[model samples]
Target: MALKQIWEETNMKIIVKDLSPVLLQTKNVFEVADQKLFRYGHLVLPCLSQNYGPTYFCKLEKIN
Candidate 1:
């Protein structure tokens, strides 16, 4: 199923972390996560990239 459909049906929340101020301010972090989730069924919690720095946390949850 498409990511949007899956998202709507499951009502899953995408959790993002370790985003820099620029990314947060520009909402690029969410764009990255959304693209990743759409292209791939899942994404690595903490991306191993210098841009994102270092962080070890991630969570995907369904709305109750």
Candidate 2:
């Protein structure tokens, strides 16, 4: 999580997998956390730049 924040701060692109299930299963948690952290504060809005890479793969063999 700290690495992710650093990357975001440096304006690097992030590739997160599908989170539909996570969101569906943690709606209450999301709401509570969001309310606590983002209540009247600054936020870093993402930009739609054309330089993002593919989504992160959990298990994929890399060829030498």
Candidate 3:
């Protein structure tokens, strides 16, 4: 959740998959955790998370 907090500090909306199963199951929306990220994108962070493992960041609509 620390990474998510950092993103929020910078005004970015990130979906840290696994944390939300319903969101992951959503069709044609976005692919998160376990699945390989971006066929056209690159790794953003090479660090570890305290709550989530080997963190995978997903961009999603912001929630207010």
Candidate 4:
């Protein structure tokens, strides 16, 4: 909200250096922001994630 207030109509991006699938699969994990992104954005997994061990790096492109 604060960010949007400062920079309206700008593209927003979230960079996750380390995201574990295991953590996301947990029953207690529910992030509102992540949920919104998953619902309104397209998930993109790069080839580098395949070789980077258990964690992954991904991007989300908004649906507009």
Best by lDDT: 3
Please give the CA lDDT of all the candidate structures: 0.43, 0.37, 0.44, 0.38
lDDT per residue for candidate 4 within 1-25, as digits (tens), equals 4434424666665333334454466
Candidate achieving the largest TM-score: 2
Work out the TM-score per prediction: 0.19, 0.22, 0.21, 0.19
lDDT of 2 at 1: 55
Model 4 TM: 0.19
Question: How do the candidates rank by lDDT, highest first?
Answer: 3, 1, 4, 2
- Global Cα lDDT for candidate 2: 0.37
> In candidate 1, what are the lDDT values of residues 1-64, reduced to their tens digit?
3446767786566533333344456454533344343433323244456355333223344445
Question: What is the C-alpha lDDT profile of model 3 across 1-64, one tens digit per residue?
Answer: 5655668677666544333445546434343433354532223333344232333444444444
Deviating ranges (above 4 Å) for candidate 2: 1-15, 32-64
Comparing candidate 1 with candidate 2, which one achieves the higher lDDT?
Answer: 1
Mark the regions of model 1 whose C-alpha exceeds 4 Å error after superposition: 15-64
Which pairs in model 1 have colliding backbones? none
> Deviation in angstroms for 17 in model 1?
9.4
Alpha carbon lDDT at 15, candidate 2:
41
Shift of residue 43 alpha carbon in model 1, Å = 16
